[model samples]
Target: MTVEGFDGRLDRYLSEVLSKTRSFVQKIIEEGNVWVNQTQVLKPAYKVRSGDIIRIVIPEPKQLSLVAQDIDIEVVYEDEHLAVINKPRGMVVHPGAGNFENTLVNALLHKFSGKLSSINGVIRPGIVHRLDKDTSGLLIVAKTDEAHIKLSEALKSHQIKRIYYAICEGVLKEDSGVVDAPIGRHPVNRLKMAVIPNGKQAVTYFEVLERYDKYTFVKLRLKTGRTHQIRVHMSYIGYPLLGDSTYGRSKNEFGIQGQVLHAGEIKFVHPITSDVLHFSTELPEYFLEILNILRSRNSKYHV
Candidate 1:
C-alpha cells in the first residue's frame, strides 16, 4: 500500500492503514517487519513522507508450546479439512492476556493436536475465527494450512455468512434496520470501543424477532466483522445488549452472566471441495430462559 493523505510517524501511519492498535504496530516495527523505501526502520517514531513506498511483513504466529488439557468441547461438524465447534460462554477462544489455560484452544489441542492447522500458531492451532469469551456461538477450525488460508481469505472477502441472536435493553422502533458505523478504541475509555470517524468500516443488519416489555430479541447479520462490532453498534444506536457490562448496563437484572448474545448460524463455501456448507445452532440455555420469561409475559412476536 502506498502512503498518502497524512504523514506522521511510521508506526502511527501503519496503525491507521492496518486498523490496528499503535502498540501492536510498534511491536511489529520493532521486530524489523516494516520497511520504508526498502530500508528497515526500527524506531516507531521514524518520520514518514507522503508517496514513500512502505512494505510490511506479517509473519505467521509462532507456536508457544500450548498445553493440551482434557477439557470437553462440542464439535458440530468436522471433515479432514476443517471442523466447526460450538463454543460455550465464558471460554476464551485462545491464550491471551491473563489467560493461558482451560481455553477452547487447550481443548482442541487435547482432541486434535497433531491434526490441527498451525497458521494461527500452536497457541491457537486450528482456530480460524473468534467469538468473545462471553459470547456463546459457533466457530470454524482449520485442519491444514491450505484450509486455513482459504477460509481466512473467504472471511476477509465477506463471502462467509455469519448470523447472531441477541437480546437488547429495549424495543426497536423499526421492524428492521442497519447500523453502518466506524468503530475504534474509545477516546476516554481505552478498554472500550466507540464509533469514531477514522475507525474501520463496520456494518450490521438487524431484524426484530420479538419485543418484550423492557427488552427486544433480534437477529443480526454481520456485513463486516470488527472487534466488538455488534455490541458496539447496538449500544451506539441506543439498544445495548442486556447483561453487556462493557458496552451496556452493568446491573444484573436478569440474573445472567455476560452479554445475552449468541452466534446462531453460519454459511460458507467449502474451501477444498467448493461445496456450500451451512450450520446452525440452538441458542444456549441462558438465551432460552430469557425468551421463555418474555414469552410468558405476553410479549409481541415477529418473524
Candidate 2:
C-alpha cells in the first residue's frame, strides 16, 4: 500500500489503514514481511512520508496445538461464511494462560472441526472480537479468512454495531448520555484498565431503560471497542456495574459471580452478499430474576 497524507510511525499508520491490530502489524514487521519504498523495513517505529510505497506480506496460518472438546454452545445463526453464537456467562471465549479447557473455542473446534478460519492462529481459531469471560452475549465467528478480514475491517471502521445491556449500581440522573473517555491499562494495577489521558479513544452511548432507588438498567452502544470500555467508563462516572468485582463493589446482594453486563445485540453487513444482518439475544435467567426482585422492592417502596 502507498502512504497518503500520513506522516507518522509506520506501525501506527499501517494499523489504522489496514484495520489490523498494532501488535499484529509489529509481529509481521519483525519477521521482515513489510517493505517501505521497496526496501524491507524491520522496525515498527520507522517514520513514513507521504507517497511512500508500502507492502505487507501476510504469512500462511500456522498449525495450532489445541484439543477439541465436546462442550455445549448456543449458536444463534450460521452460514457458509460466519456463525453467531449466544455465549453463556461463565464460559471463557478462548484459552489463555492458565485456562486451557472448557472454553468457547473448544466448543467451536469440536462443532466446526476443520471449518473455522485460521487467521487468529490456534488459540482463537475464528474469533473476530471478544467478550469478557463472565459477560454473556452474541459473538461472531468467521468460517473463512475472507469473511474474517471483511468483518475485521468493518469493526475497525465502526460499521459493525454492538449493543449491550447493563445493570448499574446507582440511578443515573440523565435519561441518555454519551461517555467519551480514553481507556488504557491501569498504571498501578496492571490487571485492570482505566480512563487515562494517553489511552486509546473509547466512546459509549447509554440510555436509561429502568430506574430503581439504588440501581439503573441501561442500554449501551459501543462506538469503539476498547478493552473494558463500558466497565471503566461507568465506574468513572460513579455508576459502576452491580456485580463487577473488578471496578465496582466487592459484595453484591444479587449473589452474582460477575458483572451484570450482556452483549444483547449485534448488527453488520454480510461480507460477500452485502446484506445487512442483525441478531439479538434475551438476557440470562438470573439477570431477569434480579430485575423482578428489584421491581418488587420498588413497588413496595411506592406503596
Candidate 3:
C-alpha cells in the first residue's frame, strides 16, 4: 500500500488502517515482516512518507520435513562439486506456497541425499538458480557449499551464460535485437512481472532463427537475470511467447500447456577446477514437433 497524506509512525498507521490491534502491528513489524519501500523495517516507530510503498509478507507455517520421492530426473552431467540436470517441463523446481510435495528438490534429495549443498536452507537445497514451472531445460545444482558460493558469485557478476529457444506469437522482422527493459512486479497483480520505469535492469538478446507466417522461432540470451526476464521483456515488446497465458493469450493455436520456451544451452566456469564448461541440449520432442508443424506449412514463409 502506498501511503498518501499519512505521515506518522508505521505501527499506528497499520493498526488503524488494517483494523488490527496496536500490539499485533508492532509484533509483525518487530518480526521483520513489514517493509517500507522494499526495505524491511524492524522499528515500529519508523516514520512514513506520503509516497512510500509498504509491503508485508506473512510467512506460512514451516513444513516439518521435505519428502524424498522416487521421482526420476535426468542428470546430464555431474562431478564432485556440481551437477547439471535436464529438468522437464511442468515440474516445480522447489516446494513453496500451495506446493509441498513432488518437486525437483525432493527428487534430488532422493538421489543425491547427503551430497547436495545446504546453502539455500532445507527447502531449496542445492538450488543455485531456477526456471519457471512451465519452462524446461538445463539447470545447474551445487554439490558443496564452496562450489555454491563461487557459482553464485559468478552468476551475480553476470559471468554465467544462459541461452534459450522459444516460439513466440508473432513474426519478428528484425534478424537480431535486444530487449533492454526494467522489470518489476506488476502494479496491480503481485503474481506477475511487468516493464516498469522503477524496475530492475533486464536485458534479453534475441536472434531470429525461423520466421513463419504466424510465429517466429528465436534463440535468446540473458544479460541480466531478473525473475521472468525473457518472458516479460518479450511480452513488453508486443511479441509474447506462445502459450504464455500470464502475459499473452491464455489459449494459443497450438494448444501447448506452458510457454514455448526452453533453456537449451548454458556455459560457465568450473568452480573447483577453474575449467570452462559448456552444455547444450536439443529442443524437447514436443517443442521440435511444433517447429516441424510450422515448418511444413511453407518453406517460403520461413526466412
lDDT per residue as tens, model 3, 94-198: 999879798999898888875787667678888999999999999999998779878887897899999999999988989999999999999999999999999
Candidate 3 has a TM-score of 0.80
The candidate 1 region of ten consecutive residues with least summed lDDT is 15-24
Residue pairs with backbone atoms closer than 3 Å in model 3 (clashes): none
Q: Which stretches of model 1 miss by more than 4 angstroms?
A: 1-30, 33-64, 299-303
The models' CA-based lDDT, in order, is 0.88, 0.91, 0.89
The sequence of per-residue lDDT tens digits that candidate 2 reaches over residues 221-242 is 9999999889999999999998
Residue 18 lDDT in candidate 2:
73
Q: Which one is best on lDDT?
A: 2
Top candidate, metric TM-score:
2
RMSD of each: 5.8, 3.4, 9.7
Off by over 4 Å in 2: 1-25, 33-40, 45-60, 300-303
Error of 1 at 46 (Å): 14
- How well does model 1 score by local distance difference test? 0.88
